[model samples]
Target chain A: MTEPMFRTPLRRVRGLGAARSGTGHFWHQRVTSVAGVLLTVALIVIVISLLGRSHAAAVQILGSPLIAILMLLFIINTAYHMWLGMQEIILDYVHEDKWKFLALMSNTFFVSVVGLASAFAILKLSFGV
Target chain B: MADYEARTSSGARRPRPISPHLQIYRPMLTMVMSIVHRITGSALYFGMLLLAWWLIAAASGPNAYANVEWFMGSLIGQLILFGYTWALLHHMLGGIRHLVWDTLHGFDPADREWMTVATLVGSIGLTVALWVVGYLAMGGPR
Candidate 1:
């Protein structure tokens, strides 16, 4: 009926910390993961459907605001989710502390850069900028 | 100076276990597949940048866009694009597998192995199927 004495308090809280904000990241990752799964399949379908099309036709389809918006969402979520997953991989495998920190920082920066750049591109194409 | 001071202060800091580390543990297919998923995911990050570049260039003008079109048409560029296509498919399948696991299922030893195998085979199959479609649509000429 009683808890084991040897079980440390830290062990109990290893995954359940007081810091709740981290859960937001975890939840968002899962949400985006689901979104990415659907979007990736849709993307493949769209690409295949567009196959054998002329350049102008391809551009016209991609230029639609609806397609632009979906592409924007897909790019941003994919980049962010990839960054989150890569961060975990680096933390798990990179033994050098300094290198791990650098990897984490670089991953964050790279994801943000790619996400922003992709959004910009989509906007440029959609709005003729 | 600040780093030096911090280093001196932290010099006495106990060496912590950085990571349990893959070397310390026996290699498993699941672990290898997990790492591969990450590696491919990272590669797709850059691949998206390529997509962005193409989009932006196409929006710019004929001359500006032609540069990207030319590169993508080149043999070397096609090779890279093929690799990215496979990476994207691999990572996407791996992600779906993780999502299935998160639904409080598929953690059984046999199920886990089957999921891993499925991820691998599915990714390769999807990539090849898409590339075949792409090739056929693009025409027989390389």
Candidate 2:
């Protein structure tokens, strides 16, 4: 039989490519998603608890250390997870290289702005500022 | 080495083959769920803005909080929030389904359908239950 022309299966799977980050993106996405299963549930409960509370009441509820920490965790986890996801979507659909680069850049900016703002708000509330 | 050098010198890239086009398959629950997973995820991406606004308003003090609260308490706001709730829960369940598959289980044809169904039913049930609890917490039937 003739020798196989393509790389071996084991060879193909090993090592990072030109991007220097093989599987890192996929791995981090899954890790964050696993954390998200619990965070999302906690988030829903927190929102439900605040349903009809007054401003001061909502503040009081969110001010507690436990709740504030959970909120911060959820915000950070979600921001990262969604950024990874949207990057995948943009890479897949936005075929034009110029537009694809622009989309990816915008995704980073948007997630960072929203995430930092939300985190700041939580910190302010937690510190009673 | 010479062939490699020549190819590199050319600096031209050939188009790569892509997966089969989507039109080949009839719609199925698995396919539908996969699409819904992406859609809900995309929706929740924007939904973060709502969340950010809520937190920022709270931080900015009572007057800002009250204005945000009033809008959130309005009919349109409630409708938007209701949709957001369902999307959030649905995407979370979908993520769990993915996590399970990543473990190399739940791939049976019947099992795949069941998980998709569970994702759908569970999200709707949780959304309704949470809203019911919210209404109840608001001091019952209005």
Q: Please tell me which predicted candidate would have the highest DockQ against the true structure.
A: 2
DockQ of 1: 0.38
Task: State the lDDT of candidate 2 residue by residue for A33-79, as single tens digits.
Answer: 99998998899889889988898989889978999999999999999
Worst lDDT window (10 residues) for model 1 chain B?
B1-10
The CA-based lDDT of model 2 is what? 0.91
Over the stretch B24-107, how does candidate 2's per-residue lDDT look in tens digits? Answer: 889988999999999999999999999999999998899999898898889999999999999999999999999999999999
Number of clashes in every candidate structure?
0, 0
TM-score of each: 0.78, 0.88
Q: Locate the minimum summed-lDDT window of 10 residues in model 2 chain B.
A: B1-10
Index of the highest-lDDT prediction: 2
How well is each residue in B40-64 modelled by candidate 1, as lDDT tens digits?
A: 9778866877877876766666666
Q: What DockQ does each candidate score versus the true complex, computed on alpha carbons?
A: 0.38, 0.45
